[model samples]
Target: MSEIEQLLRPELRGRTPYGAPQLDVDVRLNTNESSYPVPDAVVRAVSAELADELSGLNRYPDREFTALRTALADYLATQAGVSFDPEQLWAGNGSNEVLQHLVQAFGGPERTALGFTPAYSMHPIITETLGTRWVDGQRDAQTFDLTVESAVEQAGEVDPNLVFLCSPNNPTGSALPFEVIEAMLDAAPRALVVVDEAYAEFARPGTPTALSLLADHPRLVVTRTMSKAFTLAGGRLGYLAAAPGIIDALRLVRLPYHLSTPTQTVARIALEHADLLLETVEAIKAQRDRIVAELTALGLAPVPSDANFVLFGGLADAPATWQALLDDGVLVRDVGIAHHLRVTAGTPQETSRFLAAMSRLVPAHMMTKENP
Candidate 1:
């Protein structure tokens, strides 16, 4: 080990890092990216704003982001079906960074960060990097969800300083019930509960959102992003809705002038055409439905997803199937969980392309019952 590695904490240096797959293919469904391009109208609006604002790049961007922050809070309040104050708002480059900020502010070597396993890989990454202890609740794979009983039990054991929950969770794509989240709140009312809604837009209605309980729970912090369903993945905009006190602490740690003028302008412009973005969201929902139905027809069991992607397993076919898709110029995620693969709900054309590739691998007999 290098001297720096030696100087570093011994426990952390042994941690295994998260890995993202890099595939060589045309139809890329590895990342849960919305295949729909931004609407023509949004593109033009962003261009108009960029033209008006780009000249100011030489000057520093807004440190407070007064207008952009207000707009974010207002729009999120309306969309999340909750009331929010601008003072309760915070923004960062992405929710990944925003989450890092949370761990940094609330976590320490002595304090533990609590979360469930098989979640958005970033959760464990941030917790460990901050040198905070990680207390993980167990998962229920048979039901493909987490039980509130498990969450509460684990929280009581660790008495962690923070709890992270992802609705319609990453990788697995299952939505935890609101009651489960509330039970978790009851268990650890003192610890901050960060509900990551990165894939919130894609979740079907009636699914639970943490925003509704934010008013009653002072320790709640809800983080969201414009990257997934918003079609501005490259824009790098993430925001958090937390109590004013939490917002103030994060603001204190924030690097001055964090958001660039272009980022702020583009996010605002994107918000203006909310209707246009919802259309793409609707299409993804439809595409997701089709993907699930078709995968079942092929005798592949995909966990019912409330988000923009689905996770399925075909132990017999996983490796060969993944390689087959790649050979046929399609790319999908092999997330290292044996026999399981994650596929994004892309546009109709993209779905069709994937179907074409998959049909070639799934055999004729397995169309009714999974071949052992």
Candidate 2:
């Protein structure tokens, strides 16, 4: 390592960086992005706005993001079915930036950030980037569910300052149960519980959102995005719902001019046509069901998922499997955890392409292990 690399934030010296694939495949199911395109109406609006943009480029963006914040607060309120004052809201380029602001505000030498493993891989990377130690609660290797007993034990053991729970947890599409969340709330009342509901819109009717529990849990913060079910991955908009105090802290840490005008306009239009976009979400959910059913028939053990992607391990020689799929113009993700692989739901044609690729890659023995 170079001398500078050695001296660099000691914790970050050799950490592997997050690497997203740079390819175009027939079925690009690696990242958990919606395969749907923006509604033609919204795309035209975005284009028109871009055309109308000021040539001045001299005046900085609205420093306070005042108008954008108002629009976002109103829109998310309807989507979440929860009320939030404008003072209780803020937006960033993406939820990832919002998360970083939280770390900058709270994570430091002694403060710890807590979460579960096999989470959004970005979680640990973000914690390490802030020089904060990451403490995680264990899960059943077979099923990625957390128990109240285990969560409480970790709270006492690690004493983390911030705890993140990704409901409809990423990579593995399991939703952290309400009981488990209640137990963690009981266990770590002092810690900030960040319930990341990035895929909440895909959740079934009875599943409760962090917003539902906020009435009783003051320290809870729920961050959501328009990228998943809203089909706005390219929009770069994410929001948070928390108590006034926590929101105030985030407001203090973030840059003055954050959410851009185009982002605000597009997000507003997306929210307006949500019922239409929800058709896409329903289609994706149906697509996920078909994929899961097919995966099971092919003898892969996909964990029950409430999100867009499903995960399974025991995939035969994962790198070889991945390469095999690549050869056939079908690509998927081999997130390193034994034979673990994650695949996203896409349009029917995309789904068929992925299934054909799977037929080409998986061997008999690994298929047996995945099933039995």
Candidate 3:
């Protein structure tokens, strides 16, 4: 092995960094990023805020990010009907960084982190990178659903120190039944259970958020980000709500001034204009539903989604279809499932382009029992 390779941590020796393909194409829906651009009003506001903060760049940013935390707490209160003190909120560059913080603080050598399979890919990466043993928990192979019994059984078996759960789970695009979160808390009493709600704003109406459960369960952490429904992916602000003590633990591991002044300024301004920024949510939901309807009509199995993306199965070869879609100036995610690919819900026009690309591949690429 090369000297650098020999010197690297054994756990990371062969591991690739997490990323989805970022191919340039007409309809780019590989990542679940919002297709809408930031509103002009919000853009102008952020620019103004940045102008005011420019003179202060010479000094270090607020070590605690107090104003940004307050804004996040206010946004959570108004959005989820749950009140949190600023002390109960913590943030990082993205949800990924916040997740790493959790692993760093609560996970380490000899501890274990458990996450259901085919959920967020970052869970295992973050766990293992922190010298924590990663337990690959299972979901239903066919339905991709996790039941309370299954989750509890796995938690009991592994007794993990950290548990990662994703609501409106990535690639599958379905929300967990609230009971699953509660059962995980009970089963893994010693574990810090993180519920990633990155796509919470896109969930179908009546879907419950774990934020409400936080008042009673101190171990439960509900993480959200401005990257999704807020349409601020470039802003790189993600946060979590938990007990004040749990939030305190994260502070111990986070780097000093981890959130810069500009990040704080942009996020606070965006939170102030939350309503205007979220105006396209309904339109995106409409497109999501449209993708489901159209894909189902074409005999593909699109998982019923509560998020901005849809995971559709019954493709003969997911990677091949991914390439075909890209060739046609459209792009979707081949989430490495054997017969499934995922597509983010974009504008009506973008959705139409993607659907049209799928239509062209139907008889040749789509799977049927007879063909199989």
Name the top lDDT candidate: 3
lDDT of 2 at 288: 85
Residue-pair clash count for candidate 2: 0
> Model 3 lDDT vs. the true structure?
0.92
Candidate 2 local lDDT, 14-117, one digit each (tens): 77778879697666888788898877876776677666765634556765566666766776678777776777776677789878877777777888888887
* Per-residue lDDT of model 3, residues 174-253, tens digit only: 99999999999999999999999999999999999999999999999999898999898888999999898988888899
lDDT of each: 0.83, 0.77, 0.92
> Highest TM-score among the candidates is held by which one?
3
Off by over 4 Å in 1: 2-19, 22-24, 364-372
How many residue pairs clash in all the candidates, one count each? 0, 0, 0
**Which 10-residue window of candidate 1 scores lowest in summed lDDT?**
363-372
319 Cα displacement, candidate 3 (Å): 0.7
Q: Which pairs clash (backbone N, Cα, C closer than 3 Å) in model 2? A: none
